[model samples]
Target: MSTSRGAPGSVLAVDAGNSKTDVAVIGADGRVLGTGRGGGFQPPLVGVQVAVDTLADAVTTALEQAGADCVDHVSACLANADLPVEEEELAQAVQARGWGRSTEVRNDTFAILRAGVDEPRGVAVVCGAGINCVGMLPDGRTARFPAIGKISGDWGGGSGLAEEALWFAARAEDGRGAPTQLARTLPAHFGLASMYALIEALHLGRIPAVRQHEVAPLVFTVSAAGDPVARSLVHRLADEVVAMASVALGRLGLLTEEAPVLLGGGVLAARHPELDDRIAVLLAQRAPKAVVRVVAAPPVLGAALLGLDHVAAPAQAHRTLRAHYA
Candidate 1:
């Protein structure tokens, strides 16, 4: 529980996303001593041990910079630690590294939620390549969704939006659905003349499937230009965001009280006018006391705050940490 400088209550905070990982070492007084950034953590693809090994590289760099051999607590907010069992497994793997005296793992969405709020009490709905929601209270109670994709009753992430845009555009092009501008714009984005050509390119790997997420923003552009189908998709996404936020707020008993509904992830952070305005209207109708805000801070700050909270650090400690990030 002590650092090289003989400081107790030091924390190692980790925010591991699907694309990258960030690590920070904070003293008991909330001074950020050091930080490290490394590749993504994807246990589902690389296996747990291998994934934590990737994290170790960053952790080692951070600890070296901080002049600490270990920390009192390891607070890791990780992507793909979606379910409780997954969190437990990842926690065990992290603990086995002997990086800290204690370890806690949570879905990465909680990092965004915590990052956007002054305290632990708030709801966060993140719409990145995928969508997820989580709510928390300082008392340790939390509400969350499975967030494993369509099978988990979830929809409206960047990937989902891209897929939906393709579907409607394909249907429109083939005369199977109502005519829409998506039929033209979706294909044009890729320099193809027709949806059939775009479809062939996507199917034949001429255009990497990974590029599909790029279509999400194009959908917003079309919506802004008055495309009915594209506009509908944007509105649906807003609906999903509000639905997830309101439900999480209600579950945490924050629906009746004033609470922050923090929007995070690339899609929400972009603040598309249609999506933003629609979410505001719907959330106002559903959770009248909800105050919506898009989180601009890096989520690693949230992981660090959660660590300080775990150690019961004083309010000044939290302020100092926030100021460092600020």
Candidate 2:
């Protein structure tokens, strides 16, 4: 008798992040039968019910797109899906859908790691709407950052960049900190000309926290235009991420030139050549052998690949899975 338990058919894979949620239906051969997207499903904002509903909507759409009747399993990778209560809630909700015979819940970072490498016995640094790092040693030792955005001084993300610019601009305008072009550039971002007017507008509830994330692009643009403060901010963030990777590598004993450093996230995926060069330079200085690659596909696809691996033949299964993804 076989000691392993396997799926009876195909499966559904999901990647739920702070900005967006993606779902894919996969066949037994590891082919992506269909895919779909839904709104952000962070539980803190929408509640678990809302997140679950959003995920169900996306998964149903993927199945419809695939024209598939039944799925034997499900693997959902979601951001902030950390708490045991949250995991239980999500598991119960997905089990109701009966997409497959089994369901597994994991943090979205796990999917990012799986998406970048075949076995994921390495580190993955994700700097998307937020920034985080997760590393898994060959011995099953894992290390990850807390990754909380607000209420945590977590710096080095798109949202974090915007916030930093706002801070610098506020301080510069008040003559309380070093003068920066941000004081002038920020007013332009809001179609205003003066910092005083911008402050008045913000105090009157004209600007919200959600709108703050919009300013991140302006920081990047100003940095590219040779603004010293903006450039410093970007490089500082890059260095912070590199530091996180170094710590993760140190824990995993992958700090040498032998282990690969996998990069996966939205900020990295922007394909900013300058940013890439800067990251490479930092990695070479810090962890020379850490190979960096930008994962092009949704991390949920990687989670689905994991589900496929669970049921498929082992030796050539990875090749077949890669071929299907390709």
Candidate 3:
């Protein structure tokens, strides 16, 4: 695939996640002319064409609002585009839509990373439903993890934490593990009397499996209340976050230099004191020059900024776009 010619200096920026999508139209000078939101993009589940069709809905709305048919480039930071091959496949799919002259596809983690920094020179660790890490430099070099869950040697996402909590709670209830408050709290969260009942409800679909993510926050609550087991789990998550950040920093050759380590996603952005403090302390020990910050900006801004970068927009354009999001 090659770049298609369209309106010069215009961009169609898309940030497509597992649960939702955000699209924006940016003018040459970095003003956001229009924006739109749509349902999730899950190619692995719905197939490539179907997922792109879902994205097209939002793109159509944004283009209508902007009163334009197409733009010079499309910058899409998408979930499930974990590997370079997947990104290429997705890029081709997006380009086929004719929304832009050119398209670049990246893992959604890059949006979080780019959104948190002034320039593309940082690492980002995102821990929402799942955990992933990525790092990038202005020079176009990048470091990343496969981040495909347990089979990929990844752990400590919200769902993973909930499952870990349930495992320990179940064992504790059955005298197979150390006693912990999780045994009581885990079942209580679901209005059950025991881990046995909770287990049965989960197994029998009485409680939808999607609701299990709710347990992750309770684990933090239990830890805050000083349950040793819960605290251990929280601290372990901190370890994993720091470990990934340090490794990414090293891979980018930024470990010895002062670099931003952006924290985004539900778990990390929650500002859980225990997890935050532990991650800070551990990261400081491992990568003393690492500067950490939570990314509060919506990631569509990052996609737009990446588009501007691709087109070589002026510095004022970056500032203008950032101010709009701010």
lDDT values of the candidates?
A: 0.93, 0.75, 0.93
Compute the lDDT for candidate 2: 0.75
Q: How far is candidate 3 from the true structure (C-alpha RMSD, Å)?
A: 2.6
Where does candidate 3 clash, by residue pair? Answer: 4-101
Q: What are the per-model numbers of colliding residue pairs?
A: 0, 5, 1
Give lDDT tens digits, candidate 3, residues 21-113: 999999888988878999999999999999999998899888887888889999999999999999999999899988988999999999999
What value does the lDDT take at residue 271 in candidate 3? 97
Q: How accurate is candidate 1 locally (lDDT)?
A: 0.93
Model 2: runs farther than 4 Å from truth? 1-9, 65-70, 83-89, 137-141, 150-153, 312-325
Model 1: ten consecutive residues of lowest lDDT: 1-10
lDDT of prediction 3: 0.93
Error of 1 at 150 (Å): 0.8
Q: What local lDDT score does residue 36 receive in model 3, on the 0 to 100 scale?
A: 92
lDDT of 3 at 171: 99
TM-score of 3: 0.97
Q: What TM-score fits each model? A: 0.97, 0.86, 0.97
**What local lDDT score does residue 232 receive in model 1, on the 0 to 100 scale?**
92
